[model samples]
Target: MSGAGNDAAAPPLAGIRVLDLTRLLPGPVATMQLADMGADVLKIEDPGAGDYARAMGPVRAEVSQFFVAVNRGKRFLRLDLKDQAQREQLLALVDDADVLVESFRPGVMAKLGLGWDVLRRRKPTLVMCAISGYGQDGPFAQLAGHDINYIGYAGMLANNAGPDGTPALPNLQVGDLLGGAQSALQGILAALLAVKMGGPGRFVDISMSDAVLAHNIMPLVAVNNGAEAAPARDLLTGGVPCYNVYRTADARFMAVGALELKFWQLCCDVLQRPDLKARHWQLGQQVGGADALAVKAELDAIFAGRSLAQWTETFAASDCCVTPILTSAEALRHPLFQARRMVSQERHPTEGVYWAVAHPIKFET
Candidate 1:
């Protein structure tokens, strides 16, 4: 909270204060990143249930993993914007705050008499980030949607999933967490720069659908060039051997990502097989091809020869891009992460000395 130049242990965002009015993944993840960077983040939740994600199925003795994953390092304040007095209190909270992020539906904030326009007037230098499923003025702006809906509507989900041409449900909230979180975070940073450059703080309108579409820029380009509707059928998705997951002898999997020629060559060399780099080893030019399948099969066979542990030991420092597929628990126990202090037991007032993902960051003087 002091001058940014004097402190070294202080985080990059040390003096920045964030008023988090968003619940759930998109906004919370962004604010969590900000908090990890030393911003003072205050989460404003509804009085009773708090963020709806608190009730989602995955739980830690009642606290949802969804909630725990993205809401750390921040103070919580329960405020109901529906109440006139509470709305005034929230407006007051934003008065001198550096940034405010909210993920309500397009017009909901204006309805509550706390829109960005009014807030900008009250706090001329406050950066306001409004996150929604769609943009503020679009036809689908008022429609309620989730991560899947956002990706699907953006033409990303339908093509990026499925195995046998059947559209598979995306397991992770990729669109919401990655797309919206990145968009909002970037907007907040840009807003901060705007505040520094001149006088007024900026309003950032971030649409989850737009974020998803932006994420699919490369694939969208391919589609625009007449690629198939279901593009996951491409070599990069699963059709190729050097870039896919193969089960080891013990049923644990190995993830191989030798996309470039040299990486693939090294993988073949490490596996003690010269047959993989054959003239036909390269993935063919026309979409998915036989070369891709052959390399994948060769990699699968090489990966299958040993148990995951043996493979892990054998290639611990080798140049091949092969890696063991890890579960969350195993990843949490990995030596590099342990050495980096990426996982630690942080005492949560409610949860108590629970395992927490340490902020994967550090500051030096």
Candidate 2:
């Protein structure tokens, strides 16, 4: 029930109008980004329950943190598409809208008489984007899925496993963010550009699972190159000690991303392990082999000798690519984020002053 306004000067999408008939994370996030860049996004919700996210996550005075976090910088409207009056009203709005975004299972909008076929016929120049678990007209198009299911089906989860060989449950919704929201955003922008160039507006079908599968480029490349491409076998996926996470003395973790030879050499010098410099990934040592494991163990022990604070101090001025793994709270207070203004102070009707995560898109005049 709350909204945040953007005050930026002459945003690129200043005249764009977006009708967002999406409920949860994916579609809302896409429209939020559009709104942040000066699109007049009208978030259309069902009259009964509105967005299901309104009751999800932590709530203060019945306002869901999850909903508030992503629903900023847009206007809200409640309409019942099933009703004749509301449907007519929506059609009127569509006659003037530049874009329409939806995130329903396949056939839901078609059943409601608001499908792309109908909308495109009504306004040929309007870009319509449908975000779903699977794309339209696929065998699994109507299947219900979430982020975990999509990533798991895409084989992304298996590649990102813990030390115990179990797939780690990522806190960040990789499939939702990258596959759904970002994919939809890219398609919408492309379609908008096409419309600007006098090309017909297109229907953008964003399948989260398909997007994740397409985004699995590294593994795909490995498979194409006739490599095993198994879990933990790739050079970027815990196969080498240079690009990995190490536990520090205080139980905190430090991320090591010294992927290049020079950075790896600097890291070895920082850890006083010049002997291990020759064991770099490009030196023909088998990735995920005994040698790599042994070097990783040695680096682990060296990193465990120092706390995260000490390691931070040691590599503060070095380009060794070693950094402390920060908690969400620590990340909010970090100087790098503070300098970028990633979070901003905002006021809610009931919660008063609260923090809002700012959109990362920085536009220049």
Candidate 3:
């Protein structure tokens, strides 16, 4: 099944030729998905250092774990873009490619004589995806930034990052992977469809900042407009006790998420905490100004009385709506994640055994 042709044909992208010119997280993650889908992804790296990510430790065989995670299944082509010869060769390659993706600060490509305008003239049916921190024309367009910076500009990190305590990087590359790379991929795919509709390849201008805004639309709306979009004050954020983390007898923790009244009651019933039977979302709202210290104390005591293992076992049997909080290492071994292949192990040429967070795309086969 790992090799070509199992149940589904090789891939939906078998015939497509992609030239990946992006490095680091955003661009690489997008192309990795395309490569997994069976496109011919030729990754062009700088001949001098290869990719900056390749030397970023933890390094293996001159390839970093960061590099392998995203650059898999692609043929690596080392080209010195500064050299006129290499630029010529790259243009020749683009003439044959169906798609081209780049994340260099805008104008870098144009200065190098490999701009989309010139490339498109060479091949009419080529899709060009340009990814940047802001966009092509905004005041911040040329201003360089990374995942956290773009997230900050988009106001997602500002909302999620703490003023209550320490300001933390919110899962750093998650935003870039989702907002930039994935968005760029969707653009490329849509352009591919447009090609079939009798248009030439399209230029997809993807802005990481703009994409993050899209990602945080719901939360942004609440903040900008009214109660609907604001977070942390919401039930799922931190407002309700039913939808929060709970600790167990041991140092380990369990997440309690009984969003509905029936679910909340079920948790209370299962835990034998009848004193808090009436504490639901609607009830919590009335007691908003009042400290629910008594309720918190009771649940804390109940959770502290049981070991994490016991709580997990109990949750497995009854639908009390709670589960243990496993660390990343423990999570891989979790039966639920293993069954779904949520975590996969790969023998990285340098990093030995490394794990890949499986892309959420499922197939018919």
Candidate 4:
């Protein structure tokens, strides 16, 4: 594992001050990433209840695990945005702060008299990022939405369906994590870079729906190439059996990504099924056809003959890109996770020991 350096060799974001007026997942996660990179992040919440996530999910002595999972390495403050005095206090922070992020619906910040126009006038070089369902000037800008709604609007949810063709509720918040938080962070970084290069500080308008739509590139590529790009019909979806999930004998799952002909051949060789080697997406096997279906069924039977552990053990050192579908707990205990130090254990003075998911990006000096 890589060692975290000393205070003098601090992170790139050191000396940056961020004012985060956000709740729930999106904006808080963006600021959390900033705070992890050594920004002095001050999360300002409402005086009455603070962030809604504080009371959500499983609580350990009044602290929510979900809240702590996203809101680490940051300071917290309570401020009533409606109160003139509190708003003035936030504005005072904004004067010296480098960035301000908010995830309110359209017009909410303006209603509080702390909008970008007002804040930019107060501090000319302050970067402000607003995260919402849609952009500030869209027809659906003010519409309330969550991860599912935004991905649905972007035509992504339609592609994610169950085996019975029913739309499955996804556990991963792709729209929230990818679209809102990551997009906001990227825009904030760009705006900060611009200011560092003597450019004007700007308003970063992030629409979750727009960001998700922008990420639906594969299916759009299919459509543009005159191919059918419906749900589960595209190559990357489930059209080919080379890249798919198979059920094990014990009812657990294994993910197979033997996409290339060589990898597929390697996988078939490992399974001792030389006959299946020729049945590949690139080997004239009809995708979504009877032959493909039969091959998948054959694979299903073969995989179901063994337990997840057995199959994983068989393919452990192979280059076929096969892995067991591990649960969250199993993932935490996995050797890969341990080696990368993706999870960190810290002993809080009052709260005892707590494990946190670490940032993925690494900067090498």
Error of 3 at 163 (Å): 8.0
lDDT of 4 by residue, 1-365 (tens): 12466435778899999999999999999999999888999999998889999889767776687888889899999998899999999999998999999998888899989888899999889999999988898689878889999999997887787545666778989899889999999999999999999998899999998999999888678678897554564567777778888999999999989989999999999989988898887989877667776788888998999999999999999988989999988888788988887886776654567877888886766
User: What would the per-residue lDDT of candidate 2 be over residues 1-365, giving only the tens digit for each residue?
Assistant: 11234444577888999999997899999999999888999999998889999989777876688888888988989999999899989999999999999998888888999988899899999999999997887799878889999999998898888656689889989899999999999999999999999999899999999999999988788778887445675788888999988999999999999998999999999888899999988887788888988999998899999899999999998988988999988888888988787876788987567778777877654
Candidate 1 structure quality by residue, lDDT tens digits, 40-106: 9999999999899887765657677668878988999999889999989998888769999999888
lDDT of 2 at 111: 91
Candidate 1 residue spans exceeding 4 A from truth: 1-8, 58-62, 229-232, 279-287, 361-365
TM-score ranking, high to low: 4, 2, 1, 3
The clash count of every prediction, one per candidate, is: 1, 0, 3, 0
Error of 1 at 188 (Å): 0.6
In candidate 2 the C-alpha lDDT for residue 9 amounts to 55
Cα RMSD (angstroms) for every candidate in the order listed: 3.0, 3.1, 2.8, 1.8
lDDT of each: 0.80, 0.89, 0.79, 0.87
lDDT of 4 at 15: 96
Which sequence of candidate numbers ranks them by lDDT, best first? Answer: 2, 4, 1, 3
Misplaced by over 4 Å in model 3 are 1-8, 161-166, 224-231, 282-294, 349-351
**Model 3 misses residue 283 by how many Å?**
5.1
* Model 4 CA deviation exceeding 4 Å by range: 1-8, 227-230, 348-352
Clashing pairs for model 4 are: none
What clash pairs does model 3 have?
60-350, 222-229, 222-230
Report lDDT (Cα) of residue 156, candidate 3.
75
